[model samples]
Each structure stands twice: as C-alpha cells, then as structure tokens.
Target: MKSWSSYLKQFAIAIGVVLLIILVMDYNIRLDELNRLNEKATIVRAQATQAIQTQVALQTQIAEATSDRVTEDNARNNGEIQEGDQRVVPIPATGVPPLEISVPTPVPTRVKKWQVWMELFFGE
Candidate 1:
C-alpha cells in the first residue's frame, strides 16, 4: 500500500508539472498573438487616417474647382473668349523671311608700339 501511494503521488506531481509547462507555453503564444494584433491595428488606424486626409484634400480641390477663378482659367486654357474679346490669330510669314539690313563692319584701328608698351605697363 505505501509503495502504491508513493507511486501515485509521483505521478500526480509529474502531471502537474506538465500542465504548468503547457499553460506557460499557451500564455506565451497568446501574448505573441496579442502583440501582432496590436501592431496590425496600429497600421490600419494610420491607413484610415491617411484615407480621411486624402478625402478632405479631394473635397477642397472640388470646392476650388467650382470657383470663378478656376472657371476663368479653364476657359482661357480651352481658348474660349468672352463677349467683346478680340482674338488675334497670328499668321505665319510664308515663302521668304524679311530682308535683313546689311551694315558695313568697321575696320579695327592699328595700335602703335608705344601704345602697346603703355598698355602692358599700366594694365589699362
């Protein structure tokens, strides 16, 4: 009877140790999973914020597009003219370019030896 009881006690202790080890391992796995989820949530939050900011920027641009200044600029870009506006269409000169005026080139004056000597000494 004593030997049997001793054996049973040993088995119970071993079982308890194994259960503790399994519980600790499960806790570690759960902690890792929780951290991963938190990081993913942070990333998703940032993406959402960026999306909202982009939405706001697009709305601002839409509002600006409806303004008078933008409308006028768009019209001018499309070559649209208002009433009483005269559009001058430029005609390209064809066949030959306008005759260029010819001017005679002035001949260079001769520098004397004394003048060269004076310039070399004075640096003028």
Candidate 2:
C-alpha cells in the first residue's frame, strides 16, 4: 500500500510538470503569434504610406500636365489679338544647338535604417 501511494504521488507530480510545460509552451506560442501580428501591422502601415505618397505624386504630375496642356491650348487658340498681346517670336535654328542650363543636380543624402528607426522612436 505504501509503494502504491508513492507511485501515485510520482504520477501526479509528472502530470503536473507536463501541464506546467504545456502552459508555458502555450504562452510562448501566443507571444510569438502576437509578435508576428505586430510585424505584419507595421508592414501594412508602411505599404499604406507608400501608396499614399505614390498617389500624391501621381496627382501632382497630372495637375502639372493638365496645366501645361491648358497653356498650350490657350496659346494655340489666340488667333487674332487686338493689342498688348506679346508677339510669338520664332527663332531660326542655327547650325549649333543652344547651350543647356548648367544647374547642378541635387545630391541625395545617405540615410541608415537604424537612423530612421531611432528617429521614429526618439522623435527626430
């Protein structure tokens, strides 16, 4: 009877340890799932920002293009001008091409990913 009771106690302890391990494993799995969800959310937000920027860029380009078209149309439609209208001058093309503007292109500054992360976390 004593030996049976000892074995039962050992079985109970073994079951308890298994349950504890299972609980710990379940907690870690939930944590991992939560971490994955957070990462996905971050990626989704970045993509949304990028899409918004792209849409804004496209809208700006369309507006500029439309303005250029309107200007060109106005210039073409002005057939008979009364007074104070600027005369359109047609310059004869010479053998040599006109000199191009020599404005220097702006150079992009180098940025590190960690710097961006730090700026995001630390407010600049």
For each candidate, what TM-score against the reference? 0.60, 0.50
User: Per-residue lDDT of 1-124 in model 1, one digit per residue for the tens?
Assistant: 5698899999999999999999999999999999999999999999999999999999999999999999999999999999999998899689978898999999999999999999899975
Candidate 2: 10-residue stretch with minimal lDDT: 74-83
CA RMSD of all predictions: 10.7, 15.5
Best by TM-score: 1
lDDT of each: 0.96, 0.89
Model 1 clash count equals 0
Cα TM-score of candidate 2: 0.50
Model 2 segments beyond 4 Å from truth? 1-6, 68-70, 73-124
What's the residue-level lDDT of 80 in candidate 1? 98
